[model samples]
Target: MSVHETPRRPLRVSFEFFPPKTEAMEETLWSSVEKLAPLRPDFVSVTYGAGGSTRERTHRTVARLVSETDLPVAAHLTTVDATRAEVDDVLEEYWQAGVRHIVALRGDPPGGLGEAYAPHPGGYANAAELTAGAKARHDFEVTVGCYPEKHPESPHFEADIEMLKRKVDAGASRAITQFFYDNDVYERYLERVRAAGIDIPIVPGIMPVTNYKSLMRMAGLCGASIPRRVARLFENLDGDPATRQLVAATVAADQCLDLAERGVGEFHFYTLNRAEMAYALCHMLGVRPT
Candidate 1:
């Protein structure tokens, strides 16, 4: 009999969630949380809406997660709409609410991505400043956003790398990259970041494509290129929701396996308020429920 060996340990996982707007959505979000909690992710994050529109709801969710669950919560904060002091105050509030980690970002403009990003008059101009301010006010474990395929606003890849270095220098303990479909894109970006001497962990972010049309719209806004192959996978699946989900899980599972073979062990998943897909991928990566 031949024995197949298991990986050394399950990849460290984290989940990202957006504050729910409706009662039904909130129920779904908590249900998903309950389902995945047994896996014991490194941390879970709740996203603040653009321009801090969901600031209160985000706070409520993070606070509740801390109080009601055993999970550590990372609050997503941005420096795009408010003044420096205003944003800093919010960071302080998160600390008071028992949130010890934060995902700092130079948020999308109120007009959304693709539009010009004009910093508010008194705001920290970018993510780096937000990271520094958060660290200064408290000993928060700060995670900043990164883009593997280059931020759309950046003029070139080199410029994007320089910006990432700046964030690292400004006390970002780690970076969670924007999700991409191609493993090669992430590998190349990681190489470039390492070559630039930025030593912080750059955790890959993965988004399972449950809804092809919606995913494409989001990818377009975020500048993630959807390959023709990906499109073909969902082309004839409009009438087959179950198969589409299975395919989505398979694709993401393959992406993680490729990363793991290269020694990547940390993963951040954009859960979209759902658990089955992320949970299934993590299970395949050797994450067992505790």
Candidate 2:
């Protein structure tokens, strides 16, 4: 690392948003969308609700993006609760609405994660199957979920790699990992993926923690470990939203820079219906609107 070395080009970014449940929230959500649209993300995704509750809203948001914005939109589809035919119908609807990209997922069970995962008798069995269905229904650019620390239900790393391979074989063009604080976790998992001969892009997912308590709870439920230092950074900021946001942006910026130094170029942000922190972090990473 020499002082004469030039900085690398800004990395590509994407954002994930959930459909709003109320008028106020809808306004907030669209405001966030408008704020981040100028950054020219590779694509933006709208998440389908648990048990597919927001199916219509998700479709509407993605449809609006297609009709109203210049940014490409990826609709998140899951096969956790619906029959294969039903899920395929949703995929068909998205295609008709002009969605060319999909984030295929098995989705959380109706009972939620850590509970027993019983597949719908007639639905796609897993993300791999969902990816295959999406490809069969339409020529979509599909992205599947990856768990760098191993999905909680997976017996071991080899099993995780095998699952990823299955999805790739089923026509997934890329993988977006669950958010993690440790860059080493992503780097090591990537090495394993490459060693296994899976070469598709694996974009790291980043969740900027504006609320420490909420972040910790989500991380615990999802099997994403929070480093002690990360906890320490927010230990006493419980009452200070302003300072918490500043620290959140700084931490995410550092995480992205570390990944960039290691040659990783793509990031997927879980915006959680807010854009300020993600926008700030992108600014720090040298990303500007095209």
Candidate 3:
């Protein structure tokens, strides 16, 4: 629709940010968080790096947000290289720090995405285990990841849904999907999920594509598809960063509005620790700063 014609239904949004490695990056992340805070997202989440590499940074960032912002913050906790005790200790720390929500994950290998994934010698086996452990440790509201296109390791979609079912049974309250380009893909996945009787909220993960080449590489690693039209939108703007970002914002905003038409109320944005695009998206969706 037009800029003035927002979706009539109310929308719920959340943004994801990664822990920063440098002082400058941390400043940028905090600025973005500050800018978006007034819009009042459903919750804001900080990502844990692969294999718990950013455990301390993630904790520090979440604690700061809890202390400084009124926003409800969700800390990401992963089952990767750490032992069960180590992971449980982090859970206690989060609870003590006033974090009530967790994004439990089975992270990639310590070696990175291309490397083979293995549980630690004594760690939780997967996200389901982590979810159960998180709930048992502190009664945190747990959210787990779901792959609408099926996880790269899963042999089929059924297997993926079964894994999600296990997470739900383990007390996860919701699932956030991997970023998807096609709304039809999300709808089909939702249909299948309902058919299988897994009814938890599956919030769509929205990623604004500002850099075409970077997105292609990331999408390849994560098994997210790139539609040709999306590629075409960024085709000749590689040298024009400003124009490309505008296109990115428009493309993602259109996707979100379209999703609103399809009965989706909740959206989780992968902010890449930047606010402009995500802010633009919310504005377009009629979420004004309050």
Candidate 4:
């Protein structure tokens, strides 16, 4: 069978985490990291807050992971509300902290979530610029984000693909899509990306619905659709934590398995600072502690 038709590629997984703002949250994040470390994800990424708001926190978290764990760490960098020199310094810091991978992004608009994005006058214009800068700084394995449902600001899919092509031209090595529910959306997107001559690994981003309400909010913001069938699964479980957890795991595992059947081997999970769901999903996908 052709590689695309056969599920022969080994399953590979990675995770993304956000920096904590409080001491209690910090403890929880570390605990989650500890539990997930045994699975040996391809890499663990720490996210930069909107407009670099959590710059120091993100740096500290990523540096600690680099020093404390054997897993590869990818530090996220954004071209939001910062000068080129400032971003350069942050890149330098990541390099000094033993980081070799970067998740480069244009980040959210400086005004806030709903505001129109405007690049800082003195900073890199967008992810393409940031990706190029990181490449110039070091031999970093740069990964950029793609949207299967289309970015909220992009005029259309064609324009969105063009922007992604720019990132690829600027030296991005991989692309992890925004969280999406339907494997078909991802499958179609992969076809478009490949047709555009973009040849990087397009990893699917899986978000286990920990809280239905929160998932709705995020989905709205990121342009990910809520399939009626999937939404129906969580319709009446708002107050049941235990049941919600079970449902979330079952649904996410099914999503991954369906993708695997289509020969998708890499997954980047948005952990949301929780380990149980990701750990369970990884186990379901045949990743176990070594």
The prediction achieving the highest TM-score against the true structure is: 4
Query: Against the true structure, what is each candidate's TM-score?
Result: 0.95, 0.95, 0.95, 0.96
Which pairs of residues clash in candidate 4, taking residues 3 or more apart in a chain or in different chains?
Answer: none
Model 3 RMSD in angstroms = 3.6
Least accurate 10 contiguous residues by lDDT in model 3: 1-10
* Cα deviation of 79, candidate 3, in Å: 0.7
- Candidate 4 at residue 53, lDDT? 96
Error of 4 at 84 (Å): 0.7
lDDT value, residue 93 of candidate 1: 91
Kindly report which residue stretches of model 3 are placed more than 4 angstroms away from their true locations once superposed: 1-9
Give lDDT tens digits, candidate 2, residues 1-290.
21111234668899999988899999999999999999999999999976688998888888988999988999999988899989989999999999999999989878777687888998899999999999998999999999988998889999999999999999999999999999988888888898898888889999888788987887877789999988899989999988988888888989988887877778899999898878887887788877
Q: After TM-score superposition, what is the CA distance of residue 116 in candidate 2 from its true location, in Å?
A: 1.5
Off by over 4 Å in 4: 1-9
Residue 127 CA error for candidate 4 (Å)?
A: 0.4
Q: Write the per-residue lDDT of candidate 1 for residues 1-290, one digit (tens) a residue.
A: 10111224667989999999999999999999999999999999999888899999999999999999999899999987899888988998999999999999999999887789998998899999988899899999999999988998899999999999999898998899998988878878888888898888888899888889888887888889888877887898878999998898888888888888877888899999999888888888888797
Error of 2 at 66 (Å): 0.9
Residues 1-290, model 3: lDDT tens digits: 22121323558889999999999999999999989998899999999988788989999999999999899999998898899999999999999999999999998888877677888999999999999999898889999999989898888888999999999999998999999988888888888888888878889999888678988987887778888877888888989998987888788988998988777878899998999888888888778787
Deviation from native of the Cα of residue 219 in model 4, angstroms? 1.4
